[model samples]
Target: MAGLFANDSEQIDRRTSRSICDAVGERLQQSLRPEPRLPTHLEQLLDELKQRDRDSH
Candidate 1:
């Protein structure tokens, strides 16, 4: 009987651990996901900067 209970407890622990890992993995993926392209104004600013750098050199 004790052995059975121990097995059940271990199984529950494994499931809980897996659930926590999955949740963490999902959150990490969302945080690491690539953002959409920069806004048009930002893009333009970057382009201007690049042009200025090239001209300066």
Candidate 2:
């Protein structure tokens, strides 16, 4: 499996990759709208599921 992935020269440096990812993530966050709030009934159902989960544990 030697050389199966990016060779050393072809690989991106960690710092550069992190900065690039951060910029992209920031742009994505800016472009997306907040999701609509859940309906009351769905919220109640979610609360019930959470309670059942805690009870089981």
The parts of candidate 2 lying over 4 Å away from their true place are 1-30
Query: lDDT (CA) for every model shown?
Result: 0.90, 0.92
In model 1, the Cα lDDT at residue 1 comes to 69
Candidate 1 local lDDT, residue 11: 61
Model 1 lDDT-worst window of ten: 4-13
Q: Residue 50 deviation, candidate 2, in Å?
A: 0.4
lDDT (Cα, tens digit) per residue for candidate 2, span 1-57: 677665787778899999999999999998896998999999999999999999999
lDDT of 2 at 10: 77
Candidate 1 clash pair list: none
In candidate 2, position 47 carries an lDDT of: 99
Q: What is the C-alpha RMSD of each candidate to the true structure, in Å?
A: 6.1, 7.7
